[model samples]
Target: MSADHYFSADPAAPARPGTVEFSVAGRDYTLAVASGVFSAGRLDTGTAVLLRKAELPTAATGGTLLDLGCGYGPIACVLATEAPSTIVYAVDVNARARELAAANAEALDLAGRLRVAAPDDVPADVEFDEIWSNPPTHIGKAGLHAMLERWLPRLAPDGVAWLVINKNLGGDSLHTWLAGLGWVVSRVASQRGFRVLRVARKTA
Candidate 1:
């Protein structure tokens, strides 16, 4: 497989643009997406499931939230809309995805609350109050694990991360592995063969 598989720093595919329409908590979103990004054709089913099954942030939820592997800013945009006062950081490795995310945030008039940055661009000292992701499981177990290991530790004390994974793709094994890593991992919900995992740092 080519390295341009959504996580590449730069994708060379022709930019075929389109829009994805979805609603969360009665709020509608029609965001632009294009080729060379994750789920460019539509709002990915896993992501839709994640948003629908996971507990969404409320207006009172105020703090820095990380949208890990943000593709075109869907999760970041939704988070910004739900908690207007919070800072939503959308981090991705793909430059095209970052550009599209910035544009989407701007289109939603959420540019002030949304911060689009490459993975390394985010300040090292900053920690997240919450982290949400529909991770790129296609990256294989080792790569996926490494990616999580790098970011999950950045969760602030008492913070949690909500993740969605396909059951067929070692979801249960991942839960076990995370538990071994000392995280408090639980199966929050499951639907259409997808598992929604709630992970938090274990208290000392």
Candidate 2:
């Protein structure tokens, strides 16, 4: 159903909240989940592959970071936790997702550096040093491309973006597509039927 997707501004489903616990980079997390958000049961496999395979930020890392389509803020939380100096913007279109992500950031004591906002709510002037995402490919290729077009340009000239897509769901084709768009794309990692792509502007 079109209404079932997490990109909806408001989900009509019953809240029916619960918790999903998972670990990242050897640290554990227990996050709040409800009926309307993405992967409320556990960490999605694509995200797991992205986190495990992509290059993670370090404490020495600074500047703005974007977690595009951040669901419950798992990637954002990990980013903020690993790179204390970075300010992370966790953007989601769903109201419930923003609320839960904000709460999760607060619970992890990362509220000071993490901002959870709707995609349209983010400040237009912010540019990211690094962008992380497990983009919603189920939205269809055109919509997915539009979402990337809207945010990818915000990456700082020296910045990089990490993205994960299901191989069976057009991963290889998406890589070719990004490359065709003038971005330097690479299949940096693959696991569990997911492709972890590193995307960035080409160097002269």
Candidate 3:
């Protein structure tokens, strides 16, 4: 596999643009996608599980949200649509992925609510009221942990983060690891070999 694919800051692969269709919260989506981005061909299984099993935001929900490691802005689009009152920040390291994500949001008419940006481009003062992700586990354990450490702290005091991880890819261990880091971790669901975890800050 090319190091430039999916996880790199700038993938060298051709865009080879395409579209991926999926449903969440009884709503259907057809988002723009391309080669060099994660899950270019279709909606990834782990992400499908996450969207299906996790408690999605409702129309009444209102706050700044996050879609970490957002590929072509699937989660970000869904979150923004589900909670029209909220704004979603979609963060990714892959330049091509960010481009595709922004384009997808624009295509879906969610550009006003969903903001796509490179990881470091997010404002320092911004905090998330909720976070959603199907992180890039292929990045390896250390890299994954570092990515989480970088974003999870940005959650508001009462915020929650929903994550889905492949069981064969150390899902359970990741749950334990988050607990060891003093975050409250809960296994919300398990389906199709994926673990849906709800993570939050420890309360007083």
Candidate 4:
């Protein structure tokens, strides 16, 4: 059995370069992908649902944004393209994914606004105005929760985080878990067995 996984810090699988083409908000994207990254073959269903259902930022949107677990820069690219005035930081644990994400950003002329970096490489002082992700459930409950615990607090006081989770993969439970952590999480949309969640800090 191979130890390689998309979440692996360093995937042992040889990089087989490819491309994934998908349309979002009427805009077409052809991003570079490889075997070591998440959803290398196509846009992930959960991610697609998140992108389709979430309230995407517009050209007027500014401030820093974060694309957590950004694989190959799909979400990062889209966010940067949609919000021309915003700076997007795409963070991922996988080194190969980071490389592919940076390449994709550069290819789409979004490199100026999109920054790709490994998780630890992101500046600790930076806080995001918006955060987006389709988390890795396969990492198990503890790991997933740890990932959220590490990132959710980095949101600006009024910042919002958009997430998509598979209903079969503890989507509802995750929502409740986030709420238990004091976040105000709501199911903004549900489609194709995926739940799109909008999460924000609770206001007094």
Candidate 5:
């Protein structure tokens, strides 16, 4: 069995190069991909759903956006393209994924606006104007919750986060959990067995 998880810092699988093409908001993207990375053979279904369902940034949106667990820069690249004035932080724990994401961003001419880095490499005080993620649900409920706990607080007071979760992977429970954490979570969309969640800080 393949011991490779998308979270593996250095995936040992052989690098099999490929390309994944997808369209979002009427824009088409063909990003270079390779083995040993998340969804190397194709654009991930969750991410595709997230992109299709979530509200993307506008051309005038000018602020820092966070793409948590950025596999190969799809979200970051799209954000950079859609919101040229905004800066995108593509963060992941996997080194190879980071490399691939950086390369993709550069290939897309988004390197100037996209910053790819490991989680700890992101500056502590940097708050995000928006966050986009299709979290690794296979990491288990506890791990997923911990991941959210670490990043969700970094959202600016008015910032919003768009997330895609498998309905069978604690999606509804996560929504309830976020509400318990004082976040205003809403199910913005549901399609192809996935749930799109929009989360924001609750105003008291």
Candidate 6:
């Protein structure tokens, strides 16, 4: 990884152009990428795991969806493509990543259903039916926890969040921490040392 953080507001590294190709739900995608973005070299392995393992929405699924830490909008595009009626909010902190995500969404003709925004740009009133993220654990435990604390509450009642974490990077600890916080956390899948956690509000 480059010294320039992918989560930086304005990446200092010079942008290097490229494309990342991947398939999801039997659909293929070739997205634009640049240096200083998260997993710019390819569709991140954790992201691919999350997308394949999580319960994808169908067209009948009607509600807002959130792709937290959306890097170039692969999950956002896939969700929009799968559930055309659902509005997908693709949020990230990096300007370059957001720009690339927006461009990719447009190129895929999913601009109408996908909204690529910065962390602070999402409207306060929106409540997501589902939140998908392969969060930036490199941000450190405190930062990662804070990010989750800030966003998980935005989930609508009965909503769920799908997350993929590298086991080496506090995946099990995160599962424990979420449970400690009174959230319902379940390990839905484990592949190549990555844990796919399905989290939801604890119910009575």
Cα lDDT listed for each candidate? 0.93, 0.92, 0.93, 0.94, 0.91, 0.93
The digit string of per-residue lDDT tens for model 1 on 61-143 reads 98899999999989999999999889999999999999999999999999998999999999999999999999999889999
Candidate 4: misplaced stretches above 4 Å? none
For this target, which candidate reaches the highest lDDT against the unseen true structure? 4
How many residue pairs clash (N, CA or C atoms closer than 3 angstroms) in each of the candidate models, in the order given? Answer: 0, 0, 0, 0, 0, 0
**Clashes in predicted model 6:** 0
- Summarize candidate 4's per-residue lDDT along 48-91 as a digit string, tens digits: 99999999999999999999999898899999999999999999
State every prediction's TM-score relative to the real structure.
Answer: 0.97, 0.98, 0.98, 0.98, 0.97, 0.97
Cand. 2 Cα-lDDT: 0.92
- Native-to-model Cα distance after best TM-score fit, residue 76 in candidate 1, in Å: 0.7
lDDT of 2 by residue, 1-204 (tens): 668578888898877798988888888989888889999988889988898899999989999999999998899999999999999999999889999999999999999999999888899999999999999887899999999999999999999999999999999999999999999999999899999999999988
- For candidate 2, what is the TM-score? 0.98
Model 2 residue 31 lDDT? 89
The residue ranges of model 1 lying beyond 4 angstroms of the native Cα positions read none
Per-residue lDDT tens digits for candidate 5, residues 1-204, read 356678888888777788899998999999988887789888888899999889899998989999999998899999999999999999998888898899999888999889999999999999999999999888889989999999999999999999999998888999899999889999999988899999998886
TM-score of 1: 0.97
Candidate 3: minimum summed lDDT over ten consecutive residues — where? Answer: 1-10
Rate residue 30 of model 4 by lDDT: 94
